[model samples]
Target: MPVTDVTTDHEALTMTLTAEFAASVDRLWKAFTDPAQLERFWGPPGWPATFPRFDFAVGGRADYYMTSPRGEKAGGSWEFLEIDEPRAFAVLDSFVDAGGAPADGLPTMRVVFAFEPTAAGSKLINTTYFTSAEALEQVVAMGAVEGSTMAFNQLDRVLAGLREYSAGKGTQTEILDDTHVRITRLVEGPRHLVWRAHQEPELMRQWLLGPDGWRMSVCEIDPAVGGRYRYEWEPLEGMPGEKFGFDGETLLWEAPRRAVTTEHMTGTDFPSTLNDLTLDEEDGATLITLVIEYPDKETRDMVLATGMTDGMEASYGRLEGVLERVG
Candidate 1:
């Protein structure tokens, strides 16, 4: 088992677990940051977790449910508080109701995950801070230590398989559910430059154009919470398709890491979709993950039918070129 030590301090109202893994810090960090990898082992042995929504950035939230063998489910939520790439992160963890809100009368704990380089590979110091001794006792009674240890034990298998699983997969899209889709791309570029390509209007204009025949006519961005951004596109001289634009307000903006926005088709009555974008860099390449939540299943199908993924792939192909020149 990876977990080497566990301790509880009643006076300090805290519990800590230390685990060592035969993987680099970056590998371990990606195991936690990537929702697809995280869900693989987040639950105990019998309970498999499904993270329907995971915005892995500061000021974001992750809603997940673990389903038991008997089909019973336990829901939980995490509000990300702090994130330091390849080093540490902290979150407020709580029991959540079906609607994903924190359940009443439930205790919330501040959990910090610290990653460090060790002689063999890497070490993880996971500490959970409870509000009081009573709260700590409540969790202990509920088998927190045993459950957490079981969850941690599964990480090694996941780490062992991740490289082969993700290698050379370029701009892939997965339908998460009826109304949600996740798109991921591993770009050969640094994180900050990738983020700037999305934020800066000049950089955006160079690559956000969907396909060869499309041109970005307008690219206005306000990179702040509650600020608005607008992108308009038109076909090149003799190409087909009408002029179209999209505008949205930023919901969360954590520099060079993550951003959430509400996107709307500029001239349509269709409901807006929530776009959550996150970037994580390991080695020299950055992994870009975008989770889009549509208003409903009908809207999702309609959008996908328009060859959205193909267009995005084309844009990302151009983006790599832009990154090459800028980088």
Candidate 2:
């Protein structure tokens, strides 16, 4: 985790966060000032941030929103108040309405981002000043601390770059808390091609097969929110394993970027899991991130213990070949 400490001073009506990153101060500053880099890890795990408007200079403004897994959106804005290159900057952060106006009665805060060089890399001291104790308490009640920590933890991956971080990782799995697990892989293709490999049924059938002896016997996909998809796999002749399938309803779908769905074992009594799939492209390669939300710790463990990561690695390896042939 990048966040080392979080201190909430009720008396001073302030919240301070201290984090260290294995990146230089210049790189850290660029990550904050650059809109593309900021959006990559600004929000918590499932909720992703997008900056529609970003003016980086002092006296400018930035408008952004975080979209939830189910496609709900919460908007926020930042008014740049001060700027010192590669060192510090401050902004007035406020909740905003859909029309980009400040939301009525919501508390605004002053946030200062201070960066400094450390022996290993760099450190960030982030302080948010609230107008009153009520404002500070309100955010805490809203899970700001937990959310911020999760958001900051993602920064390390962004700083590392997709290819540098996950090229040879081969379907990395991270148990994020009890109910959530994150799976990641880097595809050696552009974002659009990677999206198509998942979206198109023909392409999916070509590469979605988990292992060598199995084939995708059925692939019925509807690429829209609230649509349903069913996929089944069957073993080749003389193979040992039995046939299995999964069915799911799409909860959210954003072409070439994100898709969220509920997945359940077909014809079984197993509980469903929410899969939030997102793709980020950098330097002609796409990073595939899938965060699965299980109903409980037991479900999470049960699903992961089945060699899921290994299967995914095989499937993704096939996907790279599919992309190469189709590109």
Candidate 3:
């Protein structure tokens, strides 16, 4: 939601985007420089990214690729041209081959990243200069705008995790059983604030959605036992019947500590599951745990085959950013 605007100037042969993040300049800068952190949120949803080699210095190069759910890979490279730590940087962005070499007959662009302090937090302005207006239009048509937006959203999650770890919290995940999985994180915030993020629709909208170009058009929650809720997501541009949602009923509710819900995926034959969440305070941090249980092993395997675990991890990563803002 902090990604404010994106614009293109045909005459100037440039495209720019401005976004406000609930993080410090240093925290945000690290998200770009840190290879591991960059890889986590560098690609669009359903596609995980990897940075095989990253050298964040003037004249250095970064070789990376994003892998789709079907194992298809799209490679890219960045040639760093400027490095002003914690403030601004510039690079030459280009398409690359599997061996980390620039692809032939592809256009390269100059990208400048400027970070400025703001009253709320920090503002990041990205300006990309292309060789021609046609080049800019080509990239836009290839979903560059949407991909960059999703990448920034992932950066929000990275910043949040960095803040929590800096505050002495640890995050971990475990596969408890064939039909069960649990994720635990030490959130750097109060229990009540964390609970509010789960209950409030406005806060949920900020991080609940998985990727860019997809929005929660409907969010309804009732924080009482037997209360029903529904969240519907609609793509920015898609077919008429492409919309999907989740509808569920709260089985148990206890303020700021625990909640239990049974959720079903709409428009699908997927089996519903009971989600149990617990929060405990320790040393001024909230130790949060979420456990999801499916009906049986076969159903669990079917769900796992759909890549639900990776999606949930991505969503939880974004939740870190939400927590930092609310805290």
- Kindly list the per-residue Cα lDDT of model 2 for residues 96-185, writing each as its tens digit: 999999899789999999999999899999999999999999999988999999999999988888878775678999998999999999
| Regions of candidate 2 where Cα sits further than 4 Å from its true position | none
lDDT for 27 in candidate 2 is 92
Over all chains combined, what TM-score does candidate 1 have?
0.58
Rank all candidate structures by their TM-score, best first, as comma-separated numbers.
2, 1, 3
Quick one: best lDDT, which candidate?
A: 2
Predictions ranked by lDDT, top down?
A: 2, 1, 3
Which runs of model 1 end up more than 4 angstroms from their true locations? 1-104, 107-164
Residue 217 CA displacement from its true place in model 1, Å? 0.5
Model 3: colliding residue pairs: none
| Least well predicted 10-residue stretch by lDDT in candidate 2 | 161-170
Looking at candidate 1, the ten consecutive residues that score lowest on lDDT are: 157-166
Q: Give the per-residue lDDT digits (tens) of candidate 3, residues 1-327.
A: 667898889999988989998889887888778886776568755344778889888999988887652346899888999998889999999988877777876679999999999988899999999998778889999888888876676466456663453344344555555767666666667788878888899988876776555677899998778889999988777634367899988877767766778889987888788777766554466656676787888886776677665565566667778888777
**What is the alpha-carbon lDDT of model 1 when measured against the actual structure?**
0.85
Q: Candidate 1, residues 1-327: lDDT per residue as tens digits?
A: 799998999989899999999999999999999887887679765455778899988999999998653346799989999999989999999998887888887799999999999999999999999998989999999899988987897687578663344577767887766877878777878999999998988899999887789889998888777799999999999999999999999887768766778899999987999887867676677778787888899999999998888889889989999999999
